[model samples]
Target: MQAVKNRNSSINSIVESVFDKDAANFWLQKFNPLWSFNQALGKIINKDQTAVDTVSLTIQTNKKFKLGEAGQHHPVIVTVNGRCFERTYSLTQLDVDHVLLTVKRVDQGIVSNWLIEKAQLGDVIEFGQPYGDMLLPQPSSPLLLLAAGSGITPMYSLIKAALKSNVSTPIQLMYWMKHEADAAFKAELEMLAEKHANLKVQLFHTQSEHPDSRLNESYLNQVSNLENTTVYACGPSGFVSTAEQVFKSAQSFKSEAFSLSHLASDDVGFINVTLTKSHKTVAIPKGQSILVGLEQQNIQPTHGCRMGICNKCACNKAQGSTKNLVNGATNTEPGHLLKICVNSAQSDLTIDL
Candidate 1:
C-alpha cells in the first residue's frame, strides 16, 4: 500500500508537469486556479433531496486528495452571485474519494444559502486542506461527543471514524438542536448507534415537543460516567462554553466554534483602517478586529479557520500598529504580516486585505 501510494504521487506529479492546469482550465474555468495534490478539487455527486432547509452535498475528489481528521473542517470555495466565498465546512469522508458536507442555511448566511439553494451536481468546488484538532485522540478511551445545530457535521465524522477504526472504547453522543427535522444527520446517526453496540446516541430538541431543550448545567450534572471520558463539543460559542465548564473535571475536553470570540470590548474610540489595495478607509470599533469590522461593512475578505490557526486571514500591515489577540503582542513595525482574525486596529492602519 505504501508503494502504491508512492506510485500514485509520482503519477500526479508527472501529470502536473505535462498537462498544465492553466491551458486546460482557462477555457474550463476562467483564470485557471491551482489544481494541486494538496488541494481538494471536488465535484458534487449528489444532494439529499429529502433534507429540508439544510443541504448535504456528496463530493467526489481524486486520489490525490488530502485526508482530514475526523473532526476537522475544509475551507471550501464556491462562486455565488459573481462573488467567491471561502467557508469552512466539517467534512465526513464517505470513502477514499468522496466526502459529505452538510450546510445549514442561516438567516444572513450568504454562502450557506447559496450552497443549499443554487449549488448543483457536477459543479466544481475548490477546498483547502482539512484542518483542526478536535478529533478522537489516538489510543482512544471513553469519549463523549456533544454537538448542536451544524456542529453535528464534525461529531458525525468522529463517531463514524471511531467505529470504523474498530475502536472498542465507548462513544456517547448528545446532539442538541431546535427540532428533530432540524437535525442534519439524524437518520445516519441513529443507524450508526444501532449498528455499533458501543455507541450511544441522544438528542435534545430545544424548541420541539421533545424533552431536554438545552445543554446547560442541570443537564450536564445528570450525565453519567463523564469523569472517565474525554468530552468534545462543537457548536455555537454558548454551547461550547457550557460544555467546557461542565466537563472541566473530565479526563479531557475540547471544542470548536464556528466564529471567533471578540476581544473584550474597550471604549478606546474608533480607529481608521485603510485597505491598501482597495484604497478604502473604514472606521473600526475600538476592540473589534479588522476581520469582523470588514465583514460588518459587507467586505468579504478571504479567510478560513477564523481562529488565527490557519494563515488564510493573514495580511500585510504596510503601515500601522496592531495588537494580536491570541498573544496580546503588539506589532508597530511598518511592514509585517499579521493575522487579521485575532488582531485589532491599534492605530490608523493600512493593510493589504
Candidate 2:
C-alpha cells in the first residue's frame, strides 16, 4: 500500500508538471466554455431593453462567481477588438446562479457600446470580485434613495433587496433622467410601490415640456423625516455633491458617482510621468486623472472601475506629487500607493507601471 501511494503521488506530480495552468484551462474550456483553472465567468442568458439607451443582461455565472451585496459594483472584463477591457457595473442578483447587469449606452463608451450591440446570448464574460460600501444599513431606518441616469442600477438592487427583506421602514426613491422614455424599470418600480405601502417612487424628467429642476435643496422638501432617514445618492459627481450638501443633516449618508467632475485647479499644464517598468516617460496633464492621461498617450494600464472604487489601477508612486481628484487633496509622499483612476499627476513622477 505504501508503494502504491508513492507511485500515485509521483504520477500526479508528473501530470501537474506536464499540464500547466494555461494548457489545462484550454482543454477544460473546450469541454465547458465557462470552465477554467481559476476565473469567474458568466454566460449571457437573457437580454432586454430597459430604456431608450439602456439594456439589462441576465448573466448565468459559473460556480466561481460570488454574489455581492445589493449596492455594490462588479468588475466585468470583456474582449473587444482583440483587446481586453474592464468596466465596473452594478449588478442585481436574481438567483443563486444568475445576476442582472444594466448598462446605459454612452455616446462614445467602448465597453458599453460593445455590450449593448455586439454581445449575444451564450457569450461568456469574466467578473472580478464586487466592491462598494453603499449597502443597506442594519436595523433599517427610513430610507431616501436618489439616482440619476444609470445610477438607478444599484438603487434598484438595494430597493428590491430591502423590499424583499420585508423591512417596514419607508423607502422613498427619486430617480431623475433626461426624458420619461429614458426611465428604466418604470413599470416594475410602480408595481412595487403600489404593493408596498411603505414605498414611494417618483420620476423626474429634466428635459420634458414641464422640466423639473435638477437636484437641489428644494428636493429635500419632498423627503419626510429627513432628519431620521438614511440617504443614498448615486449620479454624476456634481449631482452627488449636491445631494450630499442638501442631505447633510440626514442620519446617515452614502453615495457613489458614476462620472467624476473634473476638479477646478489653479495648477495647469503638463507634468512628466516616468513608468519604471516600461522605461518610458510621458507628459500627463495636471488636474486630470493619471489613468486618462496615460490612455491619451496610448498607454493602457490595467484598470477597472475608473471611479476609483476597485483599486485595480493603483500603483506605486515612487517619486513626486499627485492630487486626489475626488477630494482635491494633494500628496507629495514618495513610495506611496496611488490610485491612478482618481489621482492626477502634480509633478514629474516616477511610478511602478
Candidate 3:
C-alpha cells in the first residue's frame, strides 16, 4: 500500500506541476496588467483580533471590482509610521463588496505590525485587484482542504462559497495548528459541519494531548481514499512543504505558500539557468535568489508572497541543481528546488520557462 501510494504521488506531482505551469501562465498574461491597473486605495473599517489579527476594508472604487477565487490573495499596501510597505493577505470574504483580511504579526514584520497596531479606521490603504490561480476545484469534485494559521483564510472562503452554492460533494478538512487559540474559524467550521452532511471537518493541534502528533504519515493513513481527493494547502513555508509531500504521496495537492522574506540567507552558491524559450543563459549568484535575478532581467515571474511562502514562484528545474532557502529545499536536493523566490542555485541549472 505504501509503495502504491508513493507511485501515485509521484505521478500526481508531475501532472500537477504541468497544470501549474499552464495555469500560472494563463493567469499571468490575463490578470497581471488588469490587476495592476485596478489597484485602489481602501479605508479600514475595523482592525481587530479573531484568534489572530483580522482587518476589514471598505474599498472606494468606481470601477467594477473583479471577484476573486475562494483561495486567491491580494496585496495590501500601506504606509506605517511614515515607511511604505506592501503585504499579501489571502481573501477571506470572496465575491463580496467589501474586503476582509486576517493576518498574524510576526516579530519585526513591518506591514503586519502596522496593520495590527496603528492602522486606524477610515485610514486609506492601497490595494490591488484579486489575482491568484490557487482556486478551489469545481463544486462537483470531492475536496480535501488543509491549512494552518492564516492559511485558513483561503479555505474559509472556499467553504463559504461551497455553502453558498449549495454544494453536495463530500468535503473533508484537516486543520493543524500549534494550539486551539491559534485556530481560526473553529466555531464556524464546526457550524458548517453540523449544517451540511456532506462536509466533514477535523482539527489537529500539535501541542494538545490529541491522538495524533501533528499531521504525519499516521494521520494521512487514516484519511479517506486518496484516489478521489483533490488537495489544497496553505500556511508556513516549512509546514506547507511537509504537507505537500504527504498529500502528493496520497492525492493531488494544489498549494499556495506565503513565506518569503524570512527565508533569505547568506548562502554562497551558484547555478546556471538556460531559458529554453528565451534562448538565454543566466548564472544565478551566491546569496542572491533566482527570482531577483530574473526580475532584474525584466522576466517578471508570477509571484505572491515574495518571501518564498507562496508557491507562485515555483519553477521546474529542468536540469542541474539548486537549494531551497525555505524549508531547506529538501525536494530539490536530488535536483528539484521548486520556488525560486527563496532558493539559490547550487550549480548550473536549466528551467522550462
**Over the stretch 176-222, how does candidate 1's per-residue lDDT look in tens digits?**
88877788778888898899999999988888765565777777755
- Error (Å) of candidate 3 at residue 141 is 1.5
Among the numbered candidates, top lDDT falls to 2
Give the worst 10-residue stretch by lDDT in candidate 1. Answer: 29-38
lDDT of 3 by residue, 1-353 (tens): 99999999999889776666545544753643223223454556666567745443334322335456777777777887777666787766533456666777677888887777777776666665667766767546788888876778888888888888888888888888777877777888999999999998988878865634766666676667777778888777777777777877554677776664345566665556788777888766755677887877778677656865446777777776666655555333434546777776666778767
Tell me how far the alpha carbon of residue 230 in candidate 2 is from the true structure, in angstroms, after superposition.
2.1
Off by over 4 Å in 3: 1-38, 52-64, 94-96, 209-212, 249-251, 260-304, 307-321, 325-339, 348-353
lDDT of 2 by residue, 1-353 (tens): 99999999999889878878888778999999889877899999999999998999999999999988999999999999999988989999899999999999987999999999999999999999999999998978999999999999999999999998998999999999999999999999999999999999999999999999999988877988888999999988778878988999999999887888766769789999999999999998887889999999999998889887778899999999988777577899998999998888888999999
Q: Which ten residues in a row have the lowest lDDT in candidate 2?
A: 256-265
Candidate 3: residue 348 lDDT (0-100): 75
lDDT of prediction 1 = 0.80
lDDT of 3: 0.70
Better of 2 and 3 by lDDT: 2
Q: TM-score of predicted model 2?
A: 0.87
